[model samples]
Target: MNYRLKLIVSFALLISLAFGIGGTLLISSSYYSLLGEEESAIINEYETLQNNLMMINHFSSASSAQNMQELIDQMVERNMAHWQALSIKSSGETILESGDQSLILNYVNSTKEGTYSYVHINEGSSRRLLLYSKMSTKNDVLDLRASFDLSTSYKQWKSQLRMFWAIYVMVVILGVAVAILFANILTKRLQSLTNATKEIAGGNLSMRTGLRTDDEFEQLSRDFDIMADQLQENIQQLKEDVQRKENFMGAVAHELKTPLTSIIGYADLMRQGGLDEGDRLTAANYIYSEGQRLEKLSHKILDLLLMEKDTFTLRKISMRSFMEQILTTTYPLARKKNVNLVVSSDDVYIFIEPDLAKSLLYNLIDNAIKATPEGGNVKVIARGIKGGCEFDISDTGCGMENKELAKITEAFYRVDKSRSRAQGGAGLGLTLCKRIVDLHNGNMVFTSKPGSGSRVVVQLFGNMSQEVDYEK
Candidate 1:
């Protein structure tokens, strides 16, 4: 069943159980209390009659047994007027009897002495109480029984019970009404949350349960909203990742297919064996050049794929020594381009994977060198920072626009595509550098404008260690 019905029914059952048990006990206690009161009154009357009989017997002026018997009979007759519905029996023979004596026989042979008992009698439409007492006299045993009509009290008790039942029914109705109201309120709130969940399931991630009750349900609603928010964020991130991968794959395919197509065309022409020696040599050269381009593209793609799965082992390395090593390797390219190369650093050590760090530096330095004009300057500076180390590569190159700088790290995204391609650039260097810096728990920041020189700063967050891995 739905929550509304379940809540209503459950509340009703609980109230019913509480009232059912309580009402039964209340009525039963009232009944016994009334019966006890009647019984007490009757017992008092029996005791009073016994006291009067004793007094009459003690003061009698009779010396003979026959005379005493005559005196007792007179006393009983005089007192009979005071006792309504009363009966007196001596030794199984009735001395005096009046009104509704039917229940007297039941107590006649009882062995109990000097005690009273109460019995209920049913006569037509009325109920009666019989109080029987046994008393001992000098000459005989007397059984005194008092009959009382309980019809009046019984009618009062029944009437009270009827009123109580009416009240109980009213209370139950009120309880049921309250239960339904509470259940509907609770269920409606829960239903709103459920509907929000359904909407989210139907791909409307913006759906939210804006419940604002100051209770636990409200907290639960808040928690549900947070969960939905996280779910939406995660799903969005997943979509972006998928889209990025698709774009990357499409770019790689295009890059690879272009070179392969050129190579294939040139090779086919050479294979046809129709061109002269010089033309055939030219075709061979074209095929070789395209093959080299394809090879370089494939290597870069492999590097990116491996970097995705690559693990790092960070160790201590001297900042100055590391820069010197990179500068030695990069000096040839700078000299070939007739660009000035400079390196400056403070003597410091940092934790880094040597190979990945070298690759990161190489990509940045190489890109800086390639971007600079023939007579421009490229500077590499390394230093100890608060947490770890920082490297700044500044180049007097043709700087990039803000928009181009934002997308420069994206694979195959070049500021000057034609110039980059002419300079043998596949546009994967910055992308690889960015990935490495991320893996090292660091960040890269670029500062440049269309005309001004560009400065790329690399920040690595790591602990400084005096010890260095000489082998690495």
Candidate 2:
């Protein structure tokens, strides 16, 4: 059965069992107690009647059975108003009798002389307590019988039993009702939780059992809500991961197709054998340049992949020396592009994986040099901060809009697509740079206006750092 019904039935059965047992015991005890009192009262009356008869025999000058019988008759006559029935017998012959003779006869002869006995009798609609005893007189021994009316006590007992059962039934029904209400209140909370679970299973992750009873149910609901939040967050993360992978694959195909198509067309021209030496040389140069672009693309893609799969160790390195190393490598590129490369830094030792850190700084400085116009300045600055260091790279080049800054670190996301392609940029440099920054437990922020220059800030925390030792 359902829980509510089960609770009601259980409560009702328990109440009925308890009340039936207790009430029956109480009524039965009360009836028997009243019956006992009646029995005692009748026995006392019989003793009193017997004593009066013996006293009469003692006082009178009587020696015959007839005189004894006359004394017994006098006693019976005096006490008949208090007794239901009375009988006096001598030698099995009835001498005096009052009240129901049949009832008296039934009990009078059954008891032996010199022995006393009392019993309860149910005769038709009446009840009685009968006492039979033998009284000795001077002339003879008399057999005496007396009875008490118990019809009223028996009738009251039956009435009480009926009334008790009636009240017992009502109280049990009331208890069952209360049990149903209590069960409903408890199960309602369970129902709410069940519904929420079903909704979440059906893909509605936002559902919640907003119970506020301040009991275990409330605590359970709070925990359930927290679990739902975590589940939704994990599912969202999975979806974003899938989308990024799809975009990455599509960008790789497009980048490879452009270089491969051009190389195939120029090689086909060389194969046809119809061009002069000058034209053939030009086509070969175009092929070589495109091949170099493809090589750069492959290296950038490998760096991005390795950044995700590999772990690195960090060592203390001088920031000034590190910046100078990066300047030396990119100085040729800056000069080739006719752009000024400037570096300024506080001498500080910071912890980093040297190769990965160099790759990160090189990509940023290279991008700055490429973006700057001829004779325009590309500035690099480094400083020591508490627990770490920061690098700021700014370029007076063709800066992009504020909206473009957010996607600049995304793979293959270039602000000026045609300009980027013309400069042989596969657009993965900032993407690789972002990944490297994340590996070092750092953050990168970019700010640029359309006409003004763009500034990129890199902050590395969770790294050991100290001011450079000039003495050393």
Candidate 3:
């Protein structure tokens, strides 16, 4: 059943149960007490009659006994009008009978002594109450009995019960009417609530249950409305985020296409085969430089995506040897600018992805060498750190300001645009390098100041903790 009906029915049942229990106790107690009082009177009369008959027997006269019985019967009739019926018996035979007197015989047999009392129910009718007794005297014993008609008492109580039931019937009729009235009102409210809920479920956030009753149900309705409002706000925010990501993707496409278009155009001019060696060489140089820029852009975008996905593996490589090889490869670039590229190692060894480690070292060293002026020095050092390997590259170069250094690893971000371009770099090398290190669960840090120097440190974690060997 619905909640409101359940509540009303529950309350009504509680009241009905209370009434039923109380009525049963009251009716039962009254019935038993009435039966007890009748029995008491019968016992008293039988005892008195027994005493008088015994005196009459001492006189040895039937006339006197009969006279005494008459007088006692008359006295009983006068004093106890509440007694419904009476009877007299002698030697197991009825001398006088009244009001279902066979009921008296049953009690006479049961009360064989001078006097006794008990409740006797009529056969086939548990509802009827009969209180009876027997008395005795000398050899010619008289059986005196008083019979109280339980049907009389039961009828009286039932008449009162009939009146009570009439009132009870009227009460039930009124209760039903009130129940329907309340049930209707509650059902209507619930139907409205259900309709509003369906609309809200169909994505209409504006729909609301406008119940204003100051109760718990009203509070729940208000809470549902608030939750719908918050849901709407969150959906709108997600839509805006999707739009922003789309715009950023378009911007990135345009940026990457610029270098590719330049490189392709230069390559086509060289392929036309209408130029001297000098012109061909120049065209080739343009194509090569633009190709490098395009490659850098492509690598940066790929790195950013990969970092988000975080798919990388650590493979065995010697950090000391890796740094030395990187220095040897970059020696020509430093020499061309009349700068010294110093390579040093504390002989650190660790297992990691060789390519990623190489890229990280190359990015930092290239940045340092490019920033260094003529006759400046770029120092590269690799050593063991706590359970990891560290590479520190420091250059006495034209370092970045605090603001520029903070964004140094951002794609396409540079302190001096033309200087970075002239140095054959696309400003993505550091960003890609940082992302690759991050994928290996490593960190990259930079220390720099404008016009003084710059230092970049990279830490690659050791394999000790990642020894969940697949081969095993």
TM-score for all models, in order of appearance: 0.89, 0.76, 0.62
| Candidate number with greatest TM-score | 1
- Candidate 3 residue-wise lDDT at 285: 89
Clashes of each: 0, 0, 0
Rank ordering of all candidates by TM-score, starting from the highest: 1, 2, 3
Expressed as tens digits, the lDDT of each residue in 1-472 for candidate 3 is 8777786686566656666567767877887788677666656655665566556665654545466657566766778434445566667666655466555555534566555555666654334434434554545555665555456566766776777677666766677667767777777777777888899789786888877778876887788778778887888789987875675477467666776787778788887888889988988888888777777767767766766775556655556667678877799889998999899887545666666677777777878888899999998888887867887889999877777767777666678888876665666788788877766668888898888899888887754334322210
True lDDT of residue 259, candidate 1:
75
Give the poorly placed runs of model 2, Cα more than 4 Å off. 1-154, 172-189, 212-218, 311-324, 345-351, 463-472
Candidate 1 lDDT over residue span 1-472, tens digit each: 9879888888888888798778878887888788788766766756666666555444554422344345446646776333337676777777766655664555443547667677688777677776777776666667777766667667877887788788888888898999999998998899999999999999999999989999988999999999999999999999999999999999988888877888888888888888999999898887877777777778778888898996666778888888889988999999999999999988877777778888899989999998899999999989989877899899999898878788999988888888876776788888989988887789999999766679999988754333456532
After superposition, candidate 3 runs with Cα above 4 Å error: 1-82, 89-128, 131-145, 149-248, 264-280, 299-319, 347-351, 381-383, 460-472
User: Would you list the C-alpha lDDT of every candidate in the order shown?
Assistant: 0.80, 0.83, 0.70
Residue pairs clashing in model 3 are none
Better of 2 and 3 by TM-score: 2
Candidate 3 is scored at a TM of 0.62
